[model samples]
Target: MAQKNETNSAKDQSNASVDQYLAKDPERLARNLARALEELGKAAAAWTEAREKGETGDVTTAPLIDMVRTFSRVSEYWLGDPTRALEAQTRLFAEFMGIWANAIRRMSEDAAADYAAPPAADKRFQDPEWGRNAFFSFLKQAYVVTSRWAADLVEGAEGLDETTRHKARFYVDQVSQALSPSNFLLTNPELFRETMASDGENLVRGMRMLAEDIAAGKGELKLRQSDASKFKVGENIAMTPGKVIARSRLVEVIQYKPVTKQVLKRPLLVVPPWINKFYILDLNPKRSFIRWAVEQGHTVFVISWVNPDERHGMLDWADYIEEGIRFALDAIEDATGERSVNAMGYCVGGTLLAASLALMAAEGDKRIASATLLTTQVDFTHAGDLKVFVDEEQIQALDKAMSGRGYLEANRMATAFNMLRAGDLIWPYVVNNYLRGRAPLPFDLLYWNSDSTRLGAANHSYYLRNCYLENNLSRGRAVLHGKPIRLEDVTIPIFNLATREDHIAPAKSVFMGSRFFGGPVEFVLAGSGHIAGVINAPDLGKYQYWTGAKPEGMLENWLPGAKENPGSWWPYWHAWIEKQDNRSVPARKLGGRRKTLGDAPGEYVRTRA
Candidate 1:
């Protein structure tokens, strides 16, 4: 009788809190709801206007159809055998029963339940109310239970091919993430409290922001990840002093001003991926790798790729190699009077550099003394979730879509990348901006992420076919400029860096590629994801890295014997570079012989997508 009275008292307290929130501003709530509806109507109209103007493409249901077909195989495997189907159903039922019993026991004893709990790393259920409130606790546990059951079903499904199974798993995860209870208003306690406290005013503001973003996107929803207005390429972000020494249709070469009196004889050339601007390597003085390298007494030249448009649609791989890499090499030689230089590439830039090096080797040209590939993949065999979108059908569809525009739209690629980590990148922004009516905090990395670039049609198609689909680069089947080039032919010493938690280029894929290089390859594994892992500064003293014997065997085996070192890999790389060639020469000024086009951060990088 005492326990029952206690439970009733708790229920009364919850009801009183809800009543207080609802009754505080009834008139204001009604007014705000009306305003929110009006703003929502405007958002719908803007979307319709953009669609009618041909700014948005027709909705494609290909992914949904593919997901359904893939899951059918899993269903067939279970449904074909009555015994297996019964077992699967019984397991789920028993789990649900356990959760229910635990909830009952918690109500009786007024203690935490032990049946089910979210992983500690899951930020979605961090609200105290999720554990304190019985209703919310039940919802969280039920969702976790069902999602795990679905995943187990996929894992247990028999006779499914590897690709089919992989697609099924990925699609299941996507669906589960999308349907998470935390994404909804009533299901999320924090959002509910905020909505009530603001008397629905939060909804009004959110609707207004939604409409503005829709109109800004011209049709599609361009999710704002950060306050982009706070950052500018030359003034605040890419502030390292430099001057543009050379320009081509595809790229502009910017030679950074040297900080030290003397510099290494072999100037460093950085080839960043054209999918984004080059400022990622020069994001402010403190975080800028360019600034750090300049301070270390090295002449640094970076290729600032132009944000391509319809005019550059026909530019192919050969064109990027010739106009981008080779043109920069010519500019470097003229400026420094150096015949040999060290080269580094990031992400897809590294892939292109690898191809260019192989081509140079084939043509008997040896200007690059050493090569460093950061988070690059020469082999796509172990490439992560990005591979899910590279089947023949999808690639052909993408080709057809690009045929009309001449280049892939920036948002399309951005959306694909966001989908890879939708829980963190997509849904959090949705809850913050659209649900809570707040703008994202200013962040340099996210600002760069939002500053996207279009991919040339020919270049993008050739890349997808040669690298992701065919796996030709590592197989020695990749042909460039009418000549098939092999990785083993180019015997330059290589420094291969792979981030441990990279989703784009898995560490294993990078480790496997080390074996393909003919010359000595030093593989170093760094902690954290792609961006933070590579841009890590030595002073910050964050994360750790590993160095092992050579990357000959599997990563799992090599890791056991590898020595773990704390902090950034920048110093380690600097040491390795010096060991390669420690000779120094007098610091060279920008534009040794060639005329300067403009100041640093170049005009090409200033062009918005």
Candidate 2:
């Protein structure tokens, strides 16, 4: 576990920006500030030198000029929204004073313990010192108030793209996370107590963890928060009874052992995202979507994607279509002798599914009986904050980083996504792991998150360029199977599920993407983030979901017609899917007549990123 933590730490360093790591260190803060000044001085000197030399030729001043211009633009934006900026600032200042006054009064009244009831999800307040001492509690409250104010400012910033505003808010959250009193050595009261009790051994361990991360060149700024050893393929996590009926270089098609005497005649093939393990859908006996589908009297088959490395780096988006979806179809056909199957996809897999369906439609193929897209974006125009990292500069830097690496590392991608909600995701771990010197939480989701997969360079690059940067897929500009494929040509009935709190694939964006589908579509809005929204089972009875037949207009127009449903949308989905089917047949074994390629999870899932 220690070795894995160190390995992950190193991966995190490589994944995140150097400034992000450096900002965590107190001693380095001044040094970095000085360094920034020195760079500005050099830029100024260069400009002055060029001017004095009467050089008509262009100089390397664009970066400095752009920086100044950006500052001016931001200043203008704030000035334009003066009322918003002023109101937020005023509220922040008022809250800061209000917190201190309340803390003082409570302490005097011997009610300091009440500070534990924080106004926000502030972990610092959970510390004993914060609850016992007015000083520490005040500082914690002050920080929270200030952070909210800054975030509000960003949210109300004028003359910026929605994404740019989000980017600003991202930095504000990161800064708040970084400035937490709990992350530092001296400011953190728990660290001081640990220092005296353990004779500095605890401090040494914290330093070692940080050092391991730095040396490993991975930017895991937070504790992993999950023990990977506890979860294994076909044991604890993906325990659904199944057998790999077909295998290829990039995928394994698993036809699950049926639980009923009769099953839906049409097989359901799940195409999960290659960016992560397929086992997310088959997490455990209770949480496994695959197991539930089988229990629903449906023949379930899932595509277990390979964790790509340099060996598979040359594989592209088109390769995923041919080797991933097409092969899975062939395997299901070979097993059931069925000409058509209901296909489902999650996240990027859904995007790929849409692309493949478009190409198939163009070629007059009728293999898919129905399609289900879970939190996917076929149209990138409204792709949410993820687009901030999709531009030329970021993509070029990623290309250089992945040049000889063969594939995009897990931490690199994970770190970026985690940063979108740094306050919720990153800061709590900084307090828990580094400051408290605690072990990772036994969280199944965190375990799955840490157990990330590699994205093939050719494939990921193609996806980013074609889908994200170019928006070619929606425009019918993307070429697949030597033909121009468009999303509008995809006529299969589609069920679109989007999570309300999914910063990764925003619900509105998913709603917008569903409109491009040529098929009759149904868009459902579930409460939660990307993973939780889809993995939610009916038994859990958690999170509300709203349903609407896919609309011709935007999400705003669709809301009036939509109806709300409590608990998991899984049952609702099953009912909708049943309508798309024709007949029922006797349940089949894992391998009735054709030989089984391997076991449930198969070998491809075991391959590490």
Candidate 3:
């Protein structure tokens, strides 16, 4: 009997330790669970009172109560018997799903009653009934697919230990809850709001949620910044005064230290996206494409646009071309005493470069020797979900909203992006970072996300109207310099790089530019998304390349022509770039004024509201 008692005690301790590990230590999960239970209890009490009053309906209070009860029960059950955690989680999920479904149905019915009118072109928001039907359809299809796949997984899964099985069960249950109808409405409020205008109650609720999210996001930013500064960083390259290029933003060109004072390499100009600072191309010693180009005996000069403000609100697409890009091109010409320089642009900056090229062509200027567009889009017909926000009505709304302010709000742009992947980007963080009082790790990409800049309203509005809505650039209908611009006009050698899995500009949309440009186009499909695809340096050995052989057909055919080679695209591009002429030219002043813009780089970027 004594031995049995000792064994039981040991088992309990073991179970407790396991639970602690599973929940991520003792402090966070334990207290969070307790507080959640208290909230649940309060919700239950509120529901009971509301039911007695008969003021509230079945939708609002019921789901809240159900969720609270499930959480409370799960918390209690886990505290008592850690081994039963899986069962508790499953029950919690099932109950949560049931409640969510009921709530969604109720909301749909309510929304239908409110928005039974004709669908105006401007007001053709997503229908709630349609959404409910779609949700059910998705749930049915997902379950059928998942179950078929799970049959195979479960065969191997049967051999798994108790803990692993528990986690699997928990995950499946979570999926079920996520598929609930109520969740459909909650998850896609932007879609919902389009069809059904939110009343005061919903508006207040949404504002509250947004406020909470903003607060939590700010906290996460602080933590991320603190953690990110600890990572190893590279040296800051010097340029013109006030134009100091750090490992962050690269800009300004006066006198640069040539590699050997041999002064014979041809003059080169680099064009980078203004959406982000130029340091992405010059991340570090090994990763910096600028460094690589310079090392290969080329006089490389990069253009850095001034981060715009209210004062620059009047700035338009033409201003960027004439003042920003054209100025830089001329500067490089004068600085190197060469007629033209190599130009490269990434993303929107690439689009601007193409426009500048068109302008130059119209003016009969021949300064551009070679132009490289990195993941730039000429046609945006298939620009994906981003199009949903670029409709005429929305553009007008944005124009009006920005007209008063003069600048497109950075936070607003960030919010639109967050809406794209609420599950992955927002809610998980809300649960982990805010509710649980834990800080998220600092990721370089997230650091870039935090470092956002506003756009001039005129520039942003023009881009949306012309590029996205009209699809003008690809159709050769875009007007530049008071003439219909055709990409064929600027017949320069072009190298375009696109990523396979870019969510922003899908490869198909970007690839259409190949046909648009009259120049010899060399297109390379890199592996990864927009940001990671561009930042893929030589040392990052996790990318594949496509030969761009298979004609751009469906995705499946496009896959086969693409060979899965090892190594980053950086070296591949470097090798290709080195093949170009390496004749030397003396550093001569460009056609632009030789006014010293202070020192190496400018300090205008550091100033923030």
* Candidate 2: worst-modelled 10 consecutive residues by lDDT: 55-64
Superposed model 2: Cα runs more than 4 Å off? 1-121, 152-158, 211-223
TM-score of 2: 0.81
lDDT of each: 0.89, 0.76, 0.56
Candidate 2 per-residue lDDT, tens place, 1-609, comes to: 999999899678545422322334455545544544454454445545545654312212332343344445555776767785587667776887777678777845864444224554555556666655555666666766777766766666667766556556555556678887777766666665554444444544444454444323232232465755577766777888889898899998998999899999999999999988888998888888999999999899899898887889888888999999999898888899888899999999999999999988988889997999999998888787677567665666667656676677776677667777776777776655554556666777787777778778889988999888999888889988677898888887899999988988988889888778787988899989898899999999899899876556888888888898899999999999988875899998776677998788888888654
Q: Which residue segments of model 3 deviate by more than 4 Å?
A: 1-256, 260-264, 421-424, 548-559, 562-564, 585-601
- Which is better, 1 or 2, measured by TM-score? 1
**Rank by lDDT (best first):** 1, 2, 3
Choose 2 or 3, whichever is better by TM-score.
2
lDDT of 1 by residue, 516-569 (tens): 888999999999988999999998899999998999989999999999999999
- Could you tell me every candidate's TM-score relative to the true structure? 0.96, 0.81, 0.63
Provide the lowest-lDDT 10-residue window in model 1.
Answer: 56-65
What's the alpha carbon RMSD for model 3? Answer: 16.4
Off by over 4 Å in 1: 1-12, 20-23, 58-60
Q: Which digits, one per residue and each the tens of the lDDT, describe model 3 over residues 1-609?
A: 999999899789757533422323345435544554554454445545545654222222332343344344434535566555565456445644654565556554634332122234412123333334434334433343443333333233334544334334433434443343323333333323321331222333332333443333331121122134433323242222122222112235433345544443456666676666565665445566665656555566666556666777777788777777777766665545567667788888888888888778878888887777788887785575556455555677677767766776555566456545544554554433433334567654565554456768888887888898898877778776677877888788788888888867778777766677776777788888887787777666777767656334544566677667676776666556655655655543322344555433345334332
